[model samples]
Target: MNLLVTGGAGFIGSHFVRAVLADRLPGLEGASVTVLDKMAYAGNFANLGPVAESKRLDFVPADASDAPVVGAALRGHDAVVHFAAAGVTGIEVLLEAAHRLDIARFVHVSTGDVYGSIDSGAWTERSPLTPTTPAAAARAGADLMALAYHCTHGLPVVVTRGSDNYGPYQHPGRTIPRLVTALLDGRAAPLSGDGGRVRDWLHVDDHCHGIALALLEGRPGEIYHVAGTVELTERDLTGLILAELDLTWDHVTATPGHKTGDHRRALDDDKIRRELGWRPRIEFSSGLATTIAWYRANPTWWRALQSE
Candidate 1:
């Protein structure tokens, strides 16, 4: 079987590529994997470094918005784990792929940001989508488009919406990485407001694991939410990082945040657990500790991205 993974060079997508090439799929037929990425600011070649020599891995430098390239690449592939998008942009191009591409399964990686800020409670698959950001709105558009294809033409597309993802190989612009990198350098992380904003944070491993489970067990046209059990305020989380390194809250500070989504992000994930028997193994506290240790070891790794 052949797998075509869009955004394969990205944080989560690269992990998926690594899993497939590592032969993680047992009892599966032959495997040939192709990764199509636009090499955008978020896509990094370093993420795919480990699988560079794998015979099953094929890297195609392109954007998912380009239909012809994606169409040609879709030929002869058995499945597609669609992670490519203007991510926060939530573009509507994939609706075209549902009918145009020949694949057995279409797995889309969506985000909880699509649900907007929960304000006071958690959201479920039954929850309504009230997106406030252009990026998230684009994701909603594409997700609905994929499902429409399923309803209209029997296209087998399944979408997974997840919480904030963190850990190794993340672009510096994100939350946890930026926080850790900043604290390690004795610098203040430009945070949003009082940093009291709450979010459901998941390890990158868990996010990819959830994606993997969806690939194997998800039903057609289904939407699953992958979430960690913990919901933390940015202040509390940043404090944890500082405390781990034996620093005080005064050691780091905050700034205004992008008013794109909700001040908080919380989602209901019981469906993925009941349906796929999936849950996060790494606790947020421990994951943050390990993430801090990794940065302490690689000093210059993310420093280069500070100017960005």
Candidate 2:
């Protein structure tokens, strides 16, 4: 199958592309991929370097908001797995283009952050979106637009809301990579507002795998929650990173009054697990260790990004 992936050069998107090329994702073996990315600050070509020579992979450095470019890119592709966070305008552009082309499947990769903070229990697919941050709000808007295309135009859209993802190739701007890189650089990692915020950390590999399953088997106009193996508070997660790097609390500095948005996030992924048989494979301890090792070994990869 031929697939067009927007934001394919970014962290999660690039991981999906590499997995497809490597045949790591089941049901996607031998599939060709066309990556459309604007190469923003978070988007890195080096993320795709591992599979750069694959004849099955094609790269397009263009904004997803460009209707002409997006419309042209949609041609001759069986499906589109959109991972770009280009907000409502980009999503509309892609949906319109996909509608014209009559694409087979449209997997709109979303985030659990759209559900905002949950004091207790987990959020089901039926949960109402209550995004507090601008980023999550934008994603929620894009998600509604995608579903509208499916309901109004029969565009066959599937939305997958994944938890926080951490693994190799993630930009340091994110929590895990940011703290790991900072600690690795022998600097104090900033802890926000007592570090009490909660997040479910899903490995990028597992997150991409869930996306693949949703793409192949998920029902049209449906939303699936791809949950992580564990939910951890910022303090607990920071402690793990420190222990892994043989650092101490002395290396972590608390930054008060800097916290914003949801203080806790969780998801009930029973729908995806029961319907698609998707579960996270990587454990938190091991996953965190390997992630730190990746940053340590490849300073050039992240150092350059941090310098920019």
Candidate 3:
């Protein structure tokens, strides 16, 4: 199959690209894949290094917002994996990709943050979207637009929102890599507000596998929540990493965080599990160990991108 993937250089995008090319998808051996990315500060080409010269992979440095560029690239492709757009850049780019791409399926990659924070219960598929960030707000608009295309233009579109994912090739500025960087450097890893905020963490490999499933198996106009099995607070999560390092909580130190994001964030994956028979394969503890090992083995890959 020939697939067009946007944001192919970013963490999750690159993971999906590698999976398809490495023939992890059954009956998809030797699949031809194209990666379209803007290579912004967050979308680094280094993430794509492993697949850069693969016989089945191609990289197109283009913005998804440019209609003609994306449209021309979409021609004759089996599907459009739209993982592009600013994770925090907001909805404008989301609308642009939908308008341009015409393919069998437009798998819109999204985050669970669009549901905002819930104090009492988990958000099901029918939960009202009350996003608190500009990025989530824009994504809501983008999700609605993709659904509209399914209804009006008869485009096969599926939207999947998942929790924060961590694994190899993740940009160092993100939470997991930041913590790993500090641990490796013997520096006081930064934590905000005593690490009270909680997040549903998924391994990137699993999350991208869910995306691949959504592209191949999902029905049009449906929404899927690709979540992992664990939800832990920043404090406990940091403590877990410290334990792996044979250190204590005192080894880490407190730092302030952006006041706007959620104090607790998690998503409900029951719908995806029931409908698609998909759930995270990597357990939280194993995922943590694997992530730590990945950082340790590939220090040069991550350390070069460390923040000042």
Identify the candidate with maximal TM-score: 2
- Cα-lDDT of candidate 1: 0.79
Model 1 spans > 4 angstroms off: 24-30, 87-98
Superposing all C-alpha atoms, what RMSD in Å does each candidate have to the true structure? 2.3, 0.9, 2.3
| C-alpha TM-score for every candidate | 0.92, 0.98, 0.93
Q: In model 3, state the lDDT of residue 288.
A: 87
Task: Show pairs that collide, candidate 3.
Answer: 91-138
What TM-score, to 2 decimals, does candidate 2 have? Answer: 0.98
Candidate 2 per-residue lDDT, tens place, 173-282, comes to 88999899998888899887878899988999999999999999999999999999988989999999999988889999887744456888898999998999998899
lDDT of each: 0.79, 0.93, 0.80
Candidate 3 lDDT, tens digit per residue, 1-308?
89888888888988888888878865467779988888886688888777788888887898877666766776668877878764433223443454455456778888888888977567877888888988778778777777777788777889999898998888878888888778888888888787888888999988987887788799998999998678888888888889888887777888877676677777889988888888689988898898899898998887777642
What ordering of candidates by TM-score runs from best to worst?
A: 2, 3, 1
Model 3 ranges with Cα > 4 A deviation: 86-102
